[model samples]
Target chain A: MKNTIETSDRPVTITIPEPEYPLHTLSVLVNNKPGVLARIAQVFSRRGYNIESLVVSPAAEMDFSRMTIGARGEESGLDQIKAQCNKLIDVISCYDHTDDAVVSKELALVKISVGASSRGEALQIAEHFGCKTLDLAPESLVFMVTGDSGKLDAMVGMMQKFGIVELVRTGKVVMTRGNGLT
Target chain B: MNAEPRDGAQTLLKCLEAGGIEVMFGYSGGAALPIFDALETAGTKIKFVLARHEQGATHMADGYARATGKPACVLVTSGPGAGNTITGIMTAHMDSVPMVIISGQQVTWMLGKDAFQEADIFGITMPIVKHSYLVKDAADIPRVTKEAIYLATSGRPGPVLIDMPKNISQGPCDAPLDAEIDLPGYNPEKAYEIDSKDVEAVAAALAKSERPLILAGHGAMLAHAGPELKELAETARIPVCNTLLGKGIFDETHELALGMLGMHGTAYANKAVCEADLIFNIGSRFDDRIIGQPDKFGKNATIIHVDIDPSEMGKMIQPDLKIVGDAKVVLAELNKHIKALPTESWLATLDGYKKRFPLSYKIQGGLKMQHVLDVWDRLTESNSIVATDVGQHQMWSAQFNKSKAPWNWISSGGAGTMGFGFPAAIGAQLGRPDDVVIAVVGDGGFQMTLCELATAVLQKLPLKILVLNNHFLGMVRQWQELFFDNRTSGVDLEGNPDFVKLAEAYGAKGFQIKRPADIEKVLTRALEYTDGPCLINCEVVKEDNVFPMIPAGAALEDMITEKPKHRMEKPTGST
Candidate 1:
């Protein structure tokens, strides 16, 4: 409903700019039940918040599950989403780890296409990056790497120089530092 | 000997009985045959109201909930029946009315196979409902039933859903009579600890402020805080203005009442709001329509917002001091320590505004919607339950009719659903059988759910339906004429059916009034007819528009008053 008035009677108003959005990781503790993960996904999709990366696993207790989700949205919009999620019965709690000091890890499996000459250098680089060798074929060397998201990115960047043939990375999983609960 | 296994339908009834749902509005279907069969044989004390359409059933349930401060249950079949109630569900959700909606689903094994009459109702209504569940087992019936009622009626009440698969309902289970729902995260009574310091701060603000006004909203009504609100307002000597949904919370006939404030609000109320020094917004979200320009809104005042929803605190208009608590509790606590203020000149100034800029409309040729409402209010003694459809008529009803009781004025405040008035009036009539229930609708909106006319006719409800027939979608036409360079779009309702004949065809009495001379007499006669539902086709001036409008983004003070073409003498004995 536009309120613009003509005939030199009303003053024109300025329209505000769109809000700023940033990527955030939230660790949500929820009841471990059927379709609980789907419910959380539905909540995010309903609010138009796309999940960049997600990892779900059983929490410290067997009856509950913890999900680490990376998403991007305006601060106010995210705040509203959090409030709405907080209202759900199965959701025990949700915490944003982006602003907190938390330990996080991701796993990546890479198969590097290696010539007989480059095999030695690839193994050296993998060892330097703390990667474990899963298999060694005639033309390719498979390595398993586990670290934080940034470390995985750097490891993949190093492997890109050796003509990486294939790669797959699990999304980040996180735990709060100290005695804080997520 | 072992006890015989009770079917799912019987268990469903037992759970509903446990929830204390005395009445339900629904239309049976193939998926819900088991439920109907159980009701037929069991002879449960619960009364079932057979509505013509599922949408009508939902609205009726919404009306029942709003009028009685209790959650009303609704039942519908799968797919279309469930989908039809979305508008009504959204309407109730937006307005914060408590309701429990039960829809039948396909057999449990056939859920994802896209079997006959399956539409994934639980998934479809996810965003709209307060909470929803797809009942997987019959053993969870009692627990789900209790949780549904609890979630729907507690803390900032809203609608909840339970999608029951036919197999679950027809299967056998022996659930406990009192099922304990273990919900660690679902605490409905999330009370806010109101600080004594904050109350003192508010009292201090009010004590020194020269032009303080109280903006009471629907939350006050929901909280049953009318008495406390009146006590607070009178104790502080602050003038009160209601939001559209907040109607009847403060007695409209009271001296301090400034009617309603917002778009198409009374000129005086908007003026008072614009000029006030301390604006206390109780239980209002300060929606866009209310605050024309957020930056400029309440510019002269320190806005103090008291509401239960913390999300609503700083959402729109930022409050200098926010009290997060129920309306009644907060008002009661404030009243304990508040001292009366001396604002004689402020009240006098508001009175002056009210007298100078009274809600006015000049009559042209045919009858006016405002006049019809004025007459209806007068004849009904301003005490009837009034439900209004959206558009020019809704605004006119809100402006002209003075609601004398709480929850008496029910309308689609946030969603503005068109066909809401008729079924809502029927629900209100059933809720308050002794009171006169009237549905004020425009011709454009009246035709939306007029099929419910059969429900009213067959049930023999004593409802008064007033159709303000203007032969056009008057509100959109007015906007087109003013804002869209006077180029009217698809707003003309040329081949509209004869509403009087339509009502008669549905076995209800119908009256037609086309002139000013017949307006009052015909309306009084229609109101006096108490046999069954009556429809009054009021062919009013086709171009009449609601005035005192705060143009979309303009400040409250920039209200545009009507410039009628010709002025006629004021009618004698008019309200």
Candidate 2:
């Protein structure tokens, strides 16, 4: 099995082994001031941790921004990152969302070319996976999908049989479920 | 509500008066000229303590804050002045000293356009300060000043920067100067509330423990929790071992007082920590120097940590239980439920360790550093506030000079900044005018900020400076001799300036002591010279090293007390 970018479609095959470096998702609240994001990023860069994925948006508060960061590192390294992040002045709070105590989602838009022969199969796959038809052209169709990052990846793989054209993905956003961490 | 309009400088002076800032340490520059003029003209009653360098001013503010437990304001000009304050701010940040630093910036119109003497001080000090504000409006002075003082002096106290633009200080405003603070995101007091459950848990642990030890840190001093801590220790009959910054927080002369515990700590203190059945770490971060090997530190103990900052918990060693609150509040609460427990047998065992491994040095040498410190300690008695620079002399001072009162021992413990002693001593003297303030610095560290001598002379501060002239960076030289095959690289000060002559040039009385016989006489004279600052240059054996040192990453039990070549047989202890 190969894990590579899906090119030329044909249901690109992929396999992922057990991760030695576990994935950690962290939700950080920070002041919505200039240079804060760069400061937060530098903290990770200085500590030698690569951010796997990041999504930042204004939080419920007027002057605060919430950032969701997904990174892969050893458990101890991840803990160190959390501790260092907490030390930053702009950072109001940093909560680790790796546990199942939170709800998370990632959005992806996949544009795939659908010939008449594969049109039926493509529509059937989209319908089965609950992917929304964002735009439908005679030859190519764009479907917007929202789910956990893994589920979105699976959807992208299944849609690859129709000859994928262009794909864009928004990382992930997370929040604790049911009146948890405020 | 109709207050007269005033310029930015007058407004800032008014705010300073409102904040109850009696004195501020600073050096004036172009950007700060308006504020200085206002200070002179407005008669706001905020006395200015001038410093030779901006760095010296910052250290003065830091020492003042550390000594008084109040926020000391620092005023400096743009780029160079702000840049010079980095070391002082970092030192304050590391030790949680309360300071408010006001750096003058280029006018708001000239910002980001490469104006002369302009600096992005707010951005530069973001990591070093607890908080910072870039004030563009003169009307914001009262509010910003109030916030800065509050943040600097509140829970987990640290330095805060306020970048006041030149235009802001020159502008006029009629805004009512109300010192009301309204920071929604900043809440330092919530998490630090005393929890009854944690107190009960701590009380229960103390009751069951056979050998419980209390490890105190800087927070205890910052919180003024010494009396409460002493009460708790006496009630529970727990022996207290202090981190370097926590030295004066407990009475060092007390029988239960195990001296400082760290790399250069006393052997008995570290041994007690290692052998304790339960450890109560109060307000200490468990710095790497203190806990050389985290896993091996207190291997037999169930550690319980109490601190104001929640982030510090489980940072070095995972404690069996943790509590987040100010040391004073938490200790006061815990003491209410604590009854005097029987710790006689356990304390007796530690007493044996203390008696067996007392911190000692060879007295036959020519002007040994220890003897100088012993003489200084005897001459000064317990009434003196001793501030030391980072090096062998610092450890020696900590070992020899017994601090009898809280906030009496000041040193750059967390950042370990060299050259912090002289300026800090000046600040301490200014802060506590009635007390004797002595700075015991190594020759190497003394040279780092020796220019502050002029500031001391000019201010007519009665600061006593003792330069332990070892002619080398003794700590580094010792480490080189032990670990680096005796390869002395940059540690030697070959042709250092004559500190006595140098002090004389700075308008200070200079005293030189070479023979061990003259240590007392010179120290006495220097102490007697209350007219202005005095510098005592004591020439001593150059190769002397601090002892009971836990080699980096080595367990506290593995201390090197003597020269490696002629070391005594190792004593076996429980690991």
Candidate 3:
């Protein structure tokens, strides 16, 4: 603590504690311009973060786009990423959505080749998860599923035993439950 | 053809003229033909300096920017022209010099086809640039130019690259010249916001600590925090040690000034840092060269880190208190509320260290670099702007050439780029026409950008080129000798062009100093050459190592103050 050359009555200790978080979900808004994705990706890649999942779509405004990014990092690194993203000229805003009340969803189209004995089991599993059958064949099937990321993960986990030929899923996208921006 | 050519090239020149850019450096090529054509007709206000190489052009602009505290301009063609400027751009980027580089590209349709004279300069310079634009549409020229200048020169200044394809610059377009700028995400004004409570916290730290020090860096120079720092340091009685880039922010002769700290820093400065209980770091990031062992640096102290960039806040040594604002603004506010500390005992203790381990050189060493620099310093008592290339001379000049003006010392601090000194001196001379500028270079490093002698001669800049010619890559050779068992390789410059004759060939004055007695006289003669730029090759001793060295990755406490008398007895260098 730095006291006055004359005074010795008061002193101070300074501390700015930064907490760590297990996961960071960031919502970003940027101009609907070219090369925005590459710009945003640079921020994460430079910090050694593999953006585990990313979903981008046109926002309500015609000239803007919204992006949802999911990555695992501590608070400092996450703050740094958001700060750098905001520094970009094209970016309008970047905010952490991890601690907000929101509705999130992911969509997946899964193709699986089931043997005759496992065919009925696969269909039953699909039916339980409320997946719509996109295509059906004697030995193969494609199903479209929409749900929260956890539900999709669970469904995909159970169907893995059936030997999924291919799986493509949209990354998680979120909107606040009430009258607030994601 | 259409009713009218869009003519973005004319508009680009007009915008640059409106931006108040008086001069620019560049090389003409195929992709840039349109801009050059526009320049030939439209550039009544701008003076363009033709550089032989793009790299030299970039560094020249860098030095101009640093000297004038304004955004300098550069223009280069696509492909190799743009590629050559990477080192210069990164150097300016690291040192936070404000510059805008306009690079021409092939037509838009040919962009990714590996067309002749094409390179992905936009992507190449992204990491190094403050911002970049591909500028596909000619209509966006005015707005982008304004925004690029604003972004480059404002908050935490850096180089901004604008890559213009041939189609956009040459083809017809009808964008208006006057345009308003808007960047929703960029907030430069935030750096000026300082809360009173934050200032109070800083005051409290100064009050409570028994021993405190101010670790100044290049950012301090950027913020122009010299007067405020002087007031506060005088008010608070804190000793200060600057980083390499932070060299000229504070007057080095002040009682509170502990020269520089880190590798190749003063022994007294390093010693003072290890014993301090509180560290007030302003503007300078904790670079590896400055803070060797990250965890150990300021380990015993409470650190308050102040920077304009928020992201720089926990990037290195985690601060006990982080205040995000310009150092100038923050220090001014802190000075208002903070009471001066009772640091008499602390000052006395540091003064003892200074007395015990002062920076010294052996006077009898055969033609020492230190002797040349020290003599030059005494001979020219004026505060000349010193730009230096990386080498033993660079370090020695930093130690010896004591300039008092803020922002007078320009060097490639972070990039450690050679070939920077000579052209940078040219740029500085151009910017500061009244002030003397000296380029302290090494024999090995001088050859890298000596091609710019033509540009220097044409400009007739009153630049003093001091080449400490040792006939070897002395810094590397010193490393090989100290750490690698003296097995030097690939460092001998056996066929160097006679530098004096070379300078004369370029239509400038030249001088050579071979003995200790000649250093002052030759350096004086070099300074007296007002007709044009001059080069002085001071042939100094080889195999000399910079002492008071905290070897790479070593903590401040472990810095060696002297070279061993027995060569074999030197401390084993870290591999």
* Candidate 2: fraction of native contacts reproduced: 0.15
lDDT tens readout by residue for model 1, B315-361: 78879988888888888888987778888999999999998889877
- Which one wins by TM-score: 1 or 3? 3
Better candidate by TM-score, 1 or 2: 1
lDDT of 2 by residue, B369-454 (tens): 89988888888776699989999999999999987788888899888999899899989989999888999999988888888998
Q: Residue-pair clashes per candidate, as listed?
A: 1, 0, 15
Label model 2 with its docking quality class: acceptable
Best by DockQ: 3
Q: Is candidate 1 or candidate 2 better by DockQ?
A: 1
**Candidate 1 CAPRI-style tier:** acceptable
Instruction: Sort by TM-score, best first.
Output: 3, 1, 2
The top-ranked prediction according to TM-score is 3
What TM-score would candidate 1 get against the native?
0.92
| Candidate rank order under lDDT | 3, 2, 1
Model 1 misplacement above 4 A: A1-21, A33-48, B1-4, B563-575
| Pick by lDDT: 2 or 3, better one | 3
Supply DockQ values for each candidate.
0.37, 0.32, 0.42
